[model samples]
Target: MHMHVALCAVLDPSEMPGGYRFEAIENLVLSRLDRLPPFTRRLVMDPLGLDHPHWIEDPEFDPIHHIRRVSCPAPGGSHELGRLVGRITSRPLPRDRPLWELWVVEGLAEGRFAIVAKVHHSAVDGMMGAGLMVNLFGMTREPAPEAPPPREEEHPVPPEPRPSDIEMLKSAARKRLAQPRKLVDLAKRTVERVGGVVERRRDPELAHGGTPLTAPRTRLNRPIGPQRDVGFARLSLAELKAIKAAVEGAKLNDVLLAVVGGALRRYLAHHDDLPEVPLVATCPIATGAGRGNNNVAAMFVPIATHLAEPEARLEAIQAATRGAKEEHAVLGKGELLQDWADLAPTTTFSVASSLYSRLKLSKHHRPVHNLIVSNVPGPPMPVYLAGAELEAAYPMGPILDGAALNVTVMSYRGQVDFGFMVARDVVPDVWRLADAVAPAFRELRDAVLGAPSEASPERSTPAE
Candidate 1:
């Protein structure tokens, strides 16, 4: 049950070649360097299969046979990287090769390196994704000491490739001509859906989170093109926590929400386009609970930033967030049968997404709710690669239609790493947005916790 999880980042391309030589924590990770393709061209996804198990290993019977690097040449640079990632992510995994790829990018103005990683979401999640980096990177700057054998065994050979790409295209055409059952299946699915939503109106839980299907339109949730913009920001855990402590009932996450609210407000205000009303930040809800798979729901809470006072804004946000949580809690307590009954119509991913992007979109979206923000907590303790201390860690999430920017925070060690990703064309000035995050955090700190002044730290990376 591996979900095809893929995410991208842009870096100082100049440092890529030298960085490439500075090996990953393990020796088994491969580098997939190649020229990038245009947006229209399709990427080749190596088929992952049962024999493959989506795991890789060296000759020895050790696990940790992951970490491949994919590099596309210069001239294409950052923009090209976007198209390459889009080409990679838009397609499903092929069932043969390992289920992940780390595109180590090169060719930039500064000595920086960007890495695009794709892993089956099933194999890794937001929490696990950050841990893997720390586990794989050494925190120490010193030369490597003697190492031991890997913790796992070698991976088995992959299964045989299915019908070749050409053959598959031909097969698809044949099915188009002869498959009426495809249409029938869809029709039956639609009628069954109609019956379910009608009955859900009476269910207590489904009735809790009002209009769970309707999401507001935001600049971030737009129909993104091939272009993308990536930026970074960070805050100390102490500072963020202080803000939470000041608020009467604020959770650490509420601090995160307030900071994001401030950042987005600043970003839109810079353009003289700040929404007079509050913006709705849609946070993901775990649909499967303990059961895994891509099962996820969302809670979109209104964040108040229109008021110039940052404290008031945080207080208002905290209240709104509490309400959202209450609603989700009620939804979670419903009986299993009620869940199925209430969720059947919502089970289809496209129904609500389409409504938000197209007709009948929410008022929050019409003016565009600032941006979508999510904070996923990670291990606070330092992790080692064979024994190298892990450094900075960043987390990213997918951008949906109508929303042009998505701000995701992953807390590692004592720092919270923030990533600001925008659709290139929609938010060409993403770096400014990243810059805004720090000041916003400070504003929350001063008003809420009365903290002192300090410089915002730079993102740390493992040294070669």
Candidate 2:
């Protein structure tokens, strides 16, 4: 999967010092590079393809290589900016360099600009990606104080020369030699989890997280092309929290998923393609231990898109999330998934993925899930980069081959920013789904808290 994650931030340059200048912004970001690790590291794959890739400091690391400048076309609006972002994300990061880039895009309307930070998924996951953005754009207008020294575990040793091929092979072999013990442990855990599943199935009160390949085939489950389309949506964090408080047993995430389900229902019904059964979403659950690593597990959740009423959908989503979490815990959270990955040969996965795509195997089988929905927490207060105020920040996650759409949400300041990334050919009118999010939220809010005295001011990037 040539997947990368990104955050597209639209800046209000009114507060910027001397307005927007590409060189000024570039220098500012370079000055703060010490705070980021992945900015200077390049991937080094195992020669025998027996192990996961290792990251090492690039001897020829240059800030200018990763930092770039671009100009938005005329009538610079959200749609124009999104188009720019789509083009940026379509390309893969070169392995010869550190897998990241920060584009300082100028020429936005009202003298606004944007920063699109793209990083390879191999270097960072949702948590680390969000952290990198925050660090890049400090909390205030001034340059941040010298970042404290990284803990020993964060960067145990100073940068060293690249390991020789023989050295890498020996390290890979050592890990392979220990795999039998890992396999035995994995088998034991698998048996225990199987028993747990059986026991849970016997309990009437227990709910299931749903299984893979059970999702109904829809227009969304198709092979994706190289091109991408993006859309933006915004929700008030306070309003979401209010609804969470009003509804019994409802968490913020449940409310968020309910909004997505309602939006999907509207979008699909508009297309006359609404499925009779509820749609399943592959929700990425964080494992909490690996702060800077891709420590995540998948939980398939029934989004209750078939439910007509907003409150009913919210209630169903709350219960579904609970069930998913329970099942996830039963599966040892992410440990089981990580163990299996560690035991498998890395090349086997690469070959299988290549074959799957080459043969168009997705059409021959039920889709694994409908789409990927990820929730990432962002800074609570206003953040600035080089003296520019961040108006809106949309976090984008990579879409898969079968599931060609990804909806990633981030709560920044008081607004929850939704980034809808879809394969251009699969969901060309992604703007419709993006535009539906607010109305969906309003319907849910009214259903739970009753009508408000006045309409809440809608805040969103004006994407076409």
Cα TM-score of candidate 2 = 0.94
Tens digits of per-residue lDDT for model 1, 285-400: 45545432234556667777677789998877777676666655544522233334333322233355666556534334453444567777776776433222334445556665
TM-score of each: 0.63, 0.94
Worst 10 residues of 1 by lDDT: 31-40
- Candidate 2 residue pairs in backbone clash: none
Off-target runs (Cα >4 Å) in candidate 1 are: 1-98, 105-116, 120-123, 130-153, 156-218, 286-288, 293-296, 333-370, 386-388, 451-464
Candidate 1 TM-score, true structure as reference: 0.63
Superposed model 2: Cα runs more than 4 Å off: 143-158, 453-455, 462-464
